[model samples]
Target: MSVYVGNLSYQATQDGLTQAFSEYGTVKRVQLPTDRETGRMRGFAFVEMGTDAEEDAAIEALDGAEWMGRDLKVNKAKPREDRGSSQGGWDNRGGSRRY
Candidate 1:
């Protein structure tokens, strides 16, 4: 099972999330996004689980729990669809470019 964690603090780290969820059950993986340039926390993350029971346990334990001085929002994650860039849309240009 996979879970999505959101509303995280910039100080939150992958290790911190793992440790926090370890109390409930084993954590398969924890992924925290960071700024591309600054390399700082992006304020959100995702967690992978080995079992549904563990996933539930983790969500119940971590959701609404404060971490890094911020309340965590943990929930099941849906598969992400690839979002293309809007610049490729012809509608925005009103037609095809001749040049």
Candidate 2:
């Protein structure tokens, strides 16, 4: 299981998260997503710990705690939903329409 950390500063780094969470237990991985177009931190991250106990400890301690000048929102990460194809709203097929 992974923990979802939200309300993080744009400047927060993976190393910083690792250091903080490591106090609870071994940190397996840290993922901080970035904006595709701007390449900036998305103000959130996902952290995977060695065990669920570590994740619980981190979540309990970090949730609503101020870190890097922002209140952290820490909790278990829900599985990502599958967003289907990229085809947008417009219909491509040409058809005659009488107004």
Candidate 3:
């Protein structure tokens, strides 16, 4: 399981996240998504720790805690929902069949 960390500063970096989370336990991975168009940090990250206990500790310690000028939203990362194909739309092309 991974931890979802939100409300991060745009300047937050993978190294910074790793360092912060490492205090709780071993930080296995840190994924900071970037905006496709602008190529900027998305203000959130996913941190995978070595153990569930470490993740729990990080979440409990960081949630609602101020860091990098923002209050963090730390929690368990939820499974990604599958967005099925749009081929079944009204027009069968992902759009409404309007007049």
Candidate 4:
């Protein structure tokens, strides 16, 4: 399982996250998502550790811990919700078209 790290600095880097989490245990992977259009960091990331224990330790140690001038929100990553449709818009308009 991976840990969800939020409220991160936009300048935060994958290597930086790995290094920070490594203090508790081995960091397996770090995913820092970016805005597609802006091509900028989304101020959050997902971190996968070598073991559940390591994840827990990192979460416990890092949650609300200030890093990079921002308080981090760290916890067990929740499964991504399925939005069903990739195309997003006003899908429910009762068949009415408005300008």
Candidate 5:
């Protein structure tokens, strides 16, 4: 299962996540997304665990937990389209200008 972790440190690395989650179980993969332009961590990442139980353990232990002084928000990751931006809105008029 894949879990999403948020409110992460900008300096966090894939290995850092892997090691942290390894306490629960084997980590399939730990991927930290980075901005293409600045090459900086996006403050979130996806971790793939070996099994559902492991995923559950990670979520239970990591959710709302503090790491490097940041409160880690852990949960199953929603797809890109499923996650609306912080602004939270939809354009009923579509992409075109009404003018």
Candidate 6:
């Protein structure tokens, strides 16, 4: 399980997140996604801790806590939903069909 941390400053870094979360327990990983076009931090991150207990502790402690000039939105991360394919619009391919 992992924790979702939101409302982060654009300047926040993985090391900073690791350091902040490490106080609760061992931090396994920190993922900070970025904008594909601009290549900028997305103002959120996912932190994987050693155990659920540690994650809970960190969540309880950090949620709504002000950090980096923003209130943290910490909680368990929801499983990623499969987005299927990117070509989900009207089928314009050349195919003959009676209307």
Q: What is the C-alpha RMSD of each candidate to the true structure, in Å?
A: 3.8, 4.9, 3.3, 4.4, 4.9, 4.1
What lDDT tens digits, residue by residue, belong to model 3 across residues 1-94? Answer: 8999999999999999999999999999999999999999889999999999999999999999999899999999999987765453575467
Give me the runs in candidate 1 sitting further than 4 Å from their true place. Answer: 85-99
Clash pairs of candidate 4?
Answer: none
Candidate with best TM-score: 3
Query: Candidate 4 on 1-99: residue-level lDDT in tens?
Result: 899999999989999999999998999899999999999999999999999999999999999999999999999999998965555445565553334
C-alpha positional error of residue 76 in candidate 6 after TM-score superposition, expressed in Å: 0.1
Ranking by TM-score: 3, 4, 6, 2, 5, 1
Candidate 4, poorest ten consecutive residues by summed lDDT? 90-99
lDDT of each: 0.82, 0.92, 0.92, 0.93, 0.89, 0.94
Instruction: Say which prediction, candidate 2 or candidate 5, comes out ahead on lDDT.
Output: 2
1-99, model 6: which lDDT tens digit per residue?
Answer: 899999999999999999999999999999999999999999999999999999999999999999999999999999999865455454456654333
TM-score, each model? 0.78, 0.85, 0.87, 0.86, 0.79, 0.85
Find the candidate with the highest lDDT and give its number: 6
Model 1 residue 30 CA deviation (Å) reads 1.1
For model 4, how many clashes? 0
In model 5, the Cα lDDT at residue 98 comes to 33
Candidate 3: count the clashes: 0
Please give the range of 10 consecutive residues that has the lowest summed lDDT in model 2.
90-99
Put down candidate 5 lDDT per residue, 22-84, tens digits, no spaces. 999999998888999998889999999999899999999999999978999999987667543
Better of 1 and 2 by lDDT: 2
lDDT of 5: 0.89
